[model samples]
Target: MSKEESFQNSVIRPVIKMLHDLLAVHFKHYMATKKLEFSQLSEKEKTNFIESSFNKDMAFRSEIRGLVIGHFSTEEFLLYATMQRGINKRINTILKERISSNRQNFVE
Candidate 1:
């Protein structure tokens, strides 16, 4: 696929889905762990909790809002892509170490 097409399908869509899933999972775990009483809070208090808990940086503020909030904007998805790239780089480094450690298996 072309760059733009791949960005739309692979980068944008997947990241949005992943972000949404992470948020939902976190909220559910928090509720179950804390036995939250959402009904006890006032309107402003509820909003405050939701925002403080869910409102992430530019990396997150947009994707969650896309599906949940009506007002959504581009919040530099590249920032997260950059972070993921760093994680993958770390994995590659570990893989490199393992291969080097077992290098004698390959040398004749």
Candidate 2:
């Protein structure tokens, strides 16, 4: 891998994983409190649910963005952003797979 990619893998990736883990815990609590069963939501409802959850935490997102910006050089930050986009796409794919699996379980 290139140096930028190596840097991202070693450094930025851990931070991303930690943030995702933290969010996962928060989301688990939210789901429990709200009686949220992802399997039951229609596709539109699921989209709305995810959007609303993020919308409720703009400050958190901004804080994370600022943290990332502060930690990286401008060029590195650009690479980090690109890597984050890939990570996000992977996350979305995982979410879809999980929801689909849950729906299948419910159906069965």
* Model 2 residue 47 CA deviation in Å: 1.6
What's the residue-level lDDT of 88 in candidate 2?
43
> lDDT of all the models against the reference?
0.41, 0.53
**Candidate 2 regions with alpha-carbon error over 4 angstroms:** 1-13, 57-108
Instruction: Find the candidate with the highest lDDT and give its number.
Output: 2
Expressed as tens digits, the lDDT of each residue in 1-108 for candidate 2 is 765557656666555445554445545555565688866779778667656654565553454344434556677667667767654434344433433334333222
RMSD of 2: 7.4
lDDT of 1 by residue, 3-107 (tens): 444444544444434454444554445445556565576756655655554443333334334432221134444433445454333323332233234323212
Question: What is the Cα-based TM-score of model 2?
Answer: 0.38
Residue 90 of model 2 has an lDDT of 41
In TM-score terms, candidate 1 sits at 0.32
What's the residue-level lDDT of 96 in candidate 1? 29
Task: State the lDDT at 52 in candidate 2.
Answer: 64
